[model samples]
Target: MKGNRRSEMSVTEMFSYIQGFLSADQDVREDIRKVVQNLEQTAREILTLLQSVHQPSGFKEIPSKCAKARELFSTVRTQMAELKTKFPVEQYYRFHEHWRFVLQRLAFLAAFVVYLENETLVTREEVAQILGIEVVREKGFHLDVEDFLAGVLIMASELSRLAVNSVTAGDYSRPLRISNFINELDSGFRLLNLKNDPLRKRYDGLKYDVKKIEEVVYDVSIRGLAKEPESGGDK
Candidate 1:
């Protein structure tokens, strides 16, 4: 009889513990959702600002747009820091799905700003720094490599569209530069042994971006719209 009583007590205690755990999980998820919503809002604002690059006169204002976007990242940094504290570091992956999409968007925004400023791919370290997160997982919340690559793929697509718009904007030289950038980016992506399905799918879309940019460049070159490479150098 005592053994059965003990068994009943153990079962009750186990369920009590599970109930508490589930409650805490729900609370944490709710908090994370609120924070992610804020992050998404910031991302939309930055995306809107950057979309101006598609306009005929937008190319000339890129520096200003990038500067404005840089300031907004400070807000993102604060929100991310708050988000990091909502759950234990060990539970990162447990709740990662809640914020993964927002983080990817933030990564893309940072990459877009860097590309506009220097026409170079933003490093993982740079993206993490811009987002005010860690590069190493042990240090706490960090940017996943897959997220960074996804962002780069997104940037490649955006650049391909820019190649088309640059022509309409009377900037023929920009399409050639974008073509070279996307071609090299495609080559780099080919070397990664990707396993993540979403990332792999994104990488697959890169070829279409490459094709579009190439078409823009070809149209420019065949029509004598491209600038001639300088003596002793082909760009």
Candidate 2:
């Protein structure tokens, strides 16, 4: 009966659990390269989707986002591969959606990667600069970086929540939190459509919220704050 119940569980969750159990077993291991390839392939799928669409022009038109998403997934895949090599891909209980594991896992990784990039790679001023320039700005760009980061933070916050919820609540008996994850992505996608008000003649699409954006960089902010002032303390 437990086996039957397990059969109904999520593939991803199962894989996660199984990976945990056989941590010492070397026979069922996954290759890091294979995981990376899977991650890269999915990213290409997203890029192809965008290329087919007529995206709006603007500084916010981060054309490389797809590539970045792929890279992030690749990182997670690499982690999974290592873990799987040490463990197994099936958990005793169900916690993953077998069919959608790739995408869901990718979403978490993509959001995580975005969170990191928001900290180290992109800056609010740089984002603002992108919006300020006429060539990029005129096409329809402006943003409230705050709004987007809210979604990312929400997404990251849920990772812990979902993981716990799965173990304690056994919610993985069903679909788990995929909807919320997708909602986070939707938040990002919606930002794609927002054009700064026509009367304002500013493209909100390219605008970024400094405070909200700062949330995603929580770790980086801590590091930045921890450092001594470049000039040193008061004399």
Model 2 stretches with alpha carbons more than 4 Å out: 1-61, 92-106, 109-153, 156-235
TM-score per model over all chains: 0.95, 0.21
Q: What is the TM-score (0 to 1) of candidate 1?
A: 0.95
Off by over 4 Å in 1: 228-235
Give the local distance difference test score of model 1: 0.89
How close is each model in CA RMSD to the real structure? 3.2, 21.4
Residue by residue across 181-201, what tens digits does model 1's lDDT show?
A: 888898999999988699999
Displacement of the residue 55 alpha carbon in candidate 2, Å = 20
lDDT of 2 by residue, 37-74 (tens): 55556654543433321222211233355354455444
Alpha-carbon error at 83 in model 2, in Å?
1.2
